[model samples]
Target: MPLARRSLIEAAAARFGWRRAYGTTTEVDQLLNEQTETAYRDAPDHAALATAKNTDALTVQPGVLDARGRVLGEVLYLEGLLAGARNRRLPQELIARLEDVVDHGHELTVLLADTVRATAAAHTAGH
Candidate 1:
């Protein structure tokens, strides 16, 4: 995979807790790696920008909830790209990887939201 794509993928994996099974290599991982390489080759500028944005978001966000929100926003941005891919009739395989990324983003968003809510509830109870 291209460096830009690999960096972005690593950042996302770290944020979302995506893990490869200990003993199994999955199709999703292969497809994602291939598609990200292709994507970087085709759009190096975009890939670099995305990687930078993700890195900056992680570093610059003020608090836990803010960082989560930034990640959620990045996911929404990626969904827009996925929509474009669908409209352009890109390969189903590539589209599938994009969908998986978006799905993970949604999962992270929900998990963060729940955490925020639980924290607020605890604070209220303490007060």
Candidate 2:
């Protein structure tokens, strides 16, 4: 609603959204780096890095990361926002949607973890 509030939302999106979404900082930074390179690859080194730092949100996806750094899907980013940081009363419909997003997040997280573990094991076994 206000400038400060909007800034706070964007900051939260970067912190809570990206980390929780991808489940790790390394992978998240990898995606961020890739996105930065994709955008400023042709620019001078310092300029590119600065641009990347400035426009990171425009580059990296807010949530989720691909194992091969490709395709992925999005889900809730603020599912736990109110629980952890703030408590705002939301409409019933919005609350239900939040619940659904969280439910889907749980399911997808488990699926992704299992798939990644299996893939790692197979690679270790020389697959």
RMSD of each: 13.8, 14.2
Q: Candidate 2's residue-wise lDDT over 7-109, tens digit each?
A: 5766888886553345577756865876687788766686566566645332322222353222223443546642433356766665777676667776777
Best by TM-score, which number?
A: 1
TM-score of 1: 0.51
Q: Deviation in angstroms for 84 in model 1? A: 0.7
- Per-residue CA lDDT of candidate 1, range 14-123, in tens? 88888533233565567677779888788758556655664533332235588688989999999998999999999999799999999999999898877677666765
Ten contiguous residues with the weakest lDDT in model 1: 54-63
- Backbone clash numbers for all candidates listed: 0, 0
Stretches off by above 4 angstroms in model 1 are 1-62
Please state the error at residue 83 of candidate 1 in Å.
0.4
Number of backbone clashes in candidate 2: 0
Q: What's the CA error at residue 114 for candidate 2, in Å?
A: 0.5
What TM-score goes with each of the models? 0.51, 0.36
